[model samples]
Target: MAVVLEVDSVDDPRIDDFRDLKAADRRPDRPGGKGLVIAEGTVVVRRMLDSPFRPHALLGVDKRWQDLAPELAAVEVPFYRASAEVMAEVVGFHLNRGVLAVAHRPPERDFDEVVADATTVAVLEGVNDHENLGSMFRNAAGLGVDAILFGDRCADPLYRRSVRVSMGHALRVPFARVPDWPGGLGLLRRRGFQVVALTPDPMAPTLATALTGDRVALLLGAEGPGLTEEAMTAADVGARIPMSAGTDSLNVATAAAMAFYERVRAS
Candidate 1:
């Protein structure tokens, strides 16, 4: 069972993982660094508790502790109870969510492991924005995307902003990094996936027409630049969402949602 400890000081080293959250250099959740996963809010915290990332400790107000009592009944970690003012001081911001849980990142699954049973997958390239990456994970979860594949230059999906925006779906969804940019796409093709690249070019076939394979891999790039020519060529086909004339293009996450919805609609 979890032990609830009342915390009166902002400088408590026991809650150090939840401290200096906004400090880019010292934050424990940064990728390629300490690699901890931080879950904010009750919903995300609940999801984190149920996910593979095990929470080491939690910092929240009393109300949050009561709200989460059922979920934490079996958890053996410490729950540091603090005032909202003290939490704000410790985290360097006014966190309205009133709850935060810090978990250590688990080992990453291999590409083959993540896709072994997937029928619909999202492949991302140059998606460096944490919010966009989070939204994509949220959309993928909502639309039933089986897994996510990271190509070149994508941001860490476990980044704090991404995890918050994903509403904890980032921790639930299966994802893996593809080792070598466009070249790694060949592995998917060899595994019998129809790699389709989403693009803004009107010359390409609509998603409805292009995404016809039983096992599909949808490739998406950054919003403005879209997919690279090399990536487009690597894919079996290029697909676009039908849009009204004169609109520039959809946001990367929005575009991904549309494609994922199309897959659902088709199914």
Candidate 2:
């Protein structure tokens, strides 16, 4: 059973964890730039509470507290109740989600641990956009990607925006960072994973033919740049989505979704 403390003033220091959400440097969630895993809205918050990332505190209006009563009964945490106006003042914006849960970032999972027992995985490179990273997690979860492996220079999937965009899927899907860039791809290959690089090259083999392996690892890159030459070289084969001629390349997340769908279809 959680404690519901009614807060009439936004200046209450007890709710500091929910303060100045938009302030890049000062936001409690963004402590030292690596923000806490923040779950906004009832759905995402419920997912977070159900996930391994445990919430330390929550802030929202009375109605949201009532709405989350069933879920709240299972956790022993503090719920800071505030009006929409006070919440907007404290968080630095009008958050229509009406509720927020803040959790400390959990330890990163080991690459081998993340991929062990997985048949399908999504490997990412240079994907710095938060929204794209979130969407990728959502797609991976939806289309049966077992885990997400990060290569180099990827965005923080635990960021608030990413969590919201992912509809809490990021919290549910397991992800890990590969120690080395292209060099680390050998780990997957050694594990019998057919590392397939996704590219825009029309000459490359179609996903249907390229993804034939007992275990498949789909490598995706940023939208404009796609995969690097080194990354492509590291893969066992290059795969394309078979788009119409003259059309631009798909967004990285969208491209990954198509490949994920193809993987499911073929299985």
Instruction: Report the error of model 1 at residue 57, Å.
Output: 0.4
Q: Give lDDT tens digits, candidate 1, residues 143-251.
A: 9999999999899999899999999999999999997989999999989999999988889999989988889999999989888889889999999899899987988
Cα lDDT computed for each candidate against the true fold: 0.93, 0.91
Candidate whose lDDT is highest: 1
Instruction: List the RMSD of every prediction in angstroms.
Output: 0.9, 1.2
TM-score of 2: 0.97
Winner by TM-score:
1
Clashes of 1: 0
Residue pair clashes in candidate 1: none
Q: What is the lDDT of residue 253 in candidate 1?
A: 95
Instruction: Give the per-residue Cα lDDT of candidate 2 at 105.
Output: 84
Model 2 spans with C-alpha error above 4 angstroms: none
